[model samples]
Target: ELFYPKNKQHWREWLFNNHHRKDAVWLVFYKKQSDRKTISWSDAVDEALCFGWIDSKVESIDKESYKQYFCQRKPNSTWSKINKEKIEKLISTNQMTKAGFKAVERAKQNGSWTILDQVEALILPEDLKQALAGYKNALEYFDGLSKSNKKMLLYWIISAKRQETRQKRINELAELAGKGQKPKQFR
Candidate 1:
């Protein structure tokens, strides 16, 4: 369903009314201008998270607006550090719903509520750093990567499902960096 709530109150009301419906997905139309009289996207995301919803893809609608999709938080969904902080604030402020608290509890129990900050800080693992150091082109390319790209590359390697996979990815990533290319799946 698509909705264009003018402000946070409307969005909150909608969530309060519909949050228990597990099958629903919302595509919220958001105006993206500092001066506009609309709920900021960040505020919308915070509100959704408070109701145990998660934002997925965002699509540009036009020059002035975009649409962001929100759906029920799935079991075992990894919690980003930023969202964990947001949940803390929401709980302190008494905004989190029972559903939201349940989601938070699950994350706490499963240990997915942590920062993947090594990527953000661009602190390469010893093994990956050694591999890069051996290839001058890779080292130079890595040094020049924007923080976001560096995070993506490192997260890809760190999130590998197995040790052998992680090692393979590290090697492949170094070769790609040496060629001044991004991972094929990076956007």
Candidate 2:
């Protein structure tokens, strides 16, 4: 069976109606028109994770775009720190459940909880900046990136787990930018 929401915010109300039965196939759509007024993808994901749900995958239905096919979390799936913080906020506000708590405990026991250890804020790290300073043309191209593109690059960098990993990413990003390349979605 399937249920769909006009946007992510409405999904919260629907979750209430369903009482989070633990096994329902929910297809959440991201109608472009939804941008007219909605809570946004980030909020939606946080709310979903708070309730022990995770995004499975999305499928585009048409030109305007329609997202599909999400389901509740299974026992084995791990959690992200970002989502864990969201759940913690939910718990503080009396929004958590035994099921949700159980999931958190499982994550803790399996080391998934700490594995998500605090992510640094999304900002352009010095490494990328250093790389760009070395190449005038690349700096020009990097400066030409739209706000969204630059923000996405910063986000991708901050999500890196280790210094070596981030250095590698910086190298790749600099090489691409040096040749007038930006992140795929940047263009």
Candidate 3:
């Protein structure tokens, strides 16, 4: 794992040092608030993703105003439209490091970075809602899903590689949910 500096001021220097590294590594950072003086997960994630890095599982060090952050560039990680937009902004602001630049270029060549998909969980777009609406039983069941169960459905729907595939999943989930079934693994 790699560790970025604690402040935004240290980003450039730290990035330069790790710019040439070929493999992904974690960068640790901290955020503090006026009230608690702590950094946020979103901030760390946004910054790390800009440099082609991803935020890994987190751990608590103590009850202090700080926590350890695990940040790394995942070569095979999928890109989300939201994160893709953030990376573009980082580039325009001259915040992207060379390794990050190469990663983006590679994604471009591979057609993974640019192709936007509904790759998030727990967000039900109108299309999916309409699809599920056709089945009243499923709709009722879907409405009764717990947050985690709903999120599983969302992840499945969003990760569908094809339109037909997603439709099929929606149907299946609806049928299962109609029977008051929670996502099997989730339940």
Candidate 4:
């Protein structure tokens, strides 16, 4: 569904009504409209977070507006550091709903809440660094990667639940890097 909320209150009302029933909504935001004001993306996200929803998959609709997908937080979704901090503030301010608190508890129980810090530094692991050394092209390609891509690759490597899986990801990344290819999703 597509919704264009005039302001944060409108967005909050929509979430109040549909946070449980709807699987997702495409929230439309005005980019440069002079006569019509709309909720900014950051504001929209803050409201959504209060209701245990998350934003993803933004798409430009026209010069004046765009749509962002918002949906209920998945059971195993990894939380970002920024979002974690936002939730903390939300809790302190008494803005978080029962559903939102439940989602946070789930993340805490499953250990995804703390994993964001592991990826924040974006450092290459010793195993991957050594592997990349044997492939000069791969090392160069990794060096040339954008900071986000590098962080993502590092996260993929370090987030593995097992040492074997982590080693496997390191090998896969090195092999892909050697071929002058980025991970499929990044490309």
RMSD, one per candidate, in order: 3.1, 6.6, 5.2, 3.1
Give every collision pair in model 2.
none
Q: Sort the candidates on lDDT, descending order.
A: 4, 1, 2, 3
In angstroms, the error of model 1 at 91 is 2.3
lDDT of 2 by residue, 37-155 (tens): 43456666655665666666766766555564556776646566567678878888886666567777887787666542322332455778898777657877877877657756765
What is the lDDT for 75 in model 2? 64
Question: Lowest-scoring 10 consecutive residues by lDDT in candidate 2?
Answer: 115-124
- TM-score, cand. 1 vs. native: 0.79
Off by over 4 Å in 1: 30-37, 61-65, 134-137, 178-181, 184-187
Candidate-wise lDDT, in order = 0.80, 0.65, 0.61, 0.87
lDDT for each residue of candidate 3 in 1-187, tens digit (9 for 90 to 100):
5454555545545545654563444444343423333235566555565566665665544344334544455554567766778787888888776667777788778767643454334556787677567666767777777765676668777668899997787777766666767546656
Better of 1 and 4 by lDDT: 4
lDDT of 4 by residue, 1-187 (tens): 8998999999999999999999899999887655678998888988999988999998998888889999999977889988988998888999888878888999899887777675676667789999887775999999898888888888888678799999888888888899999768778
Instruction: Judge candidate 1 against the unseen true structure and give its global Cα lDDT, from 0 to 1.
Output: 0.80
TM-score per model over all chains: 0.79, 0.50, 0.62, 0.80
How far out, in Å, is residue 151 in model 2? 18
Model 3: worst 10 consecutive residues (lDDT sum) = 30-39
What lDDT does candidate 1 reach at residue 37?
61
Off-target runs (Cα >4 Å) in candidate 2 are: 6-10, 16-24, 34-39, 118-187
- Winner on TM-score between 2 and 4 is 4
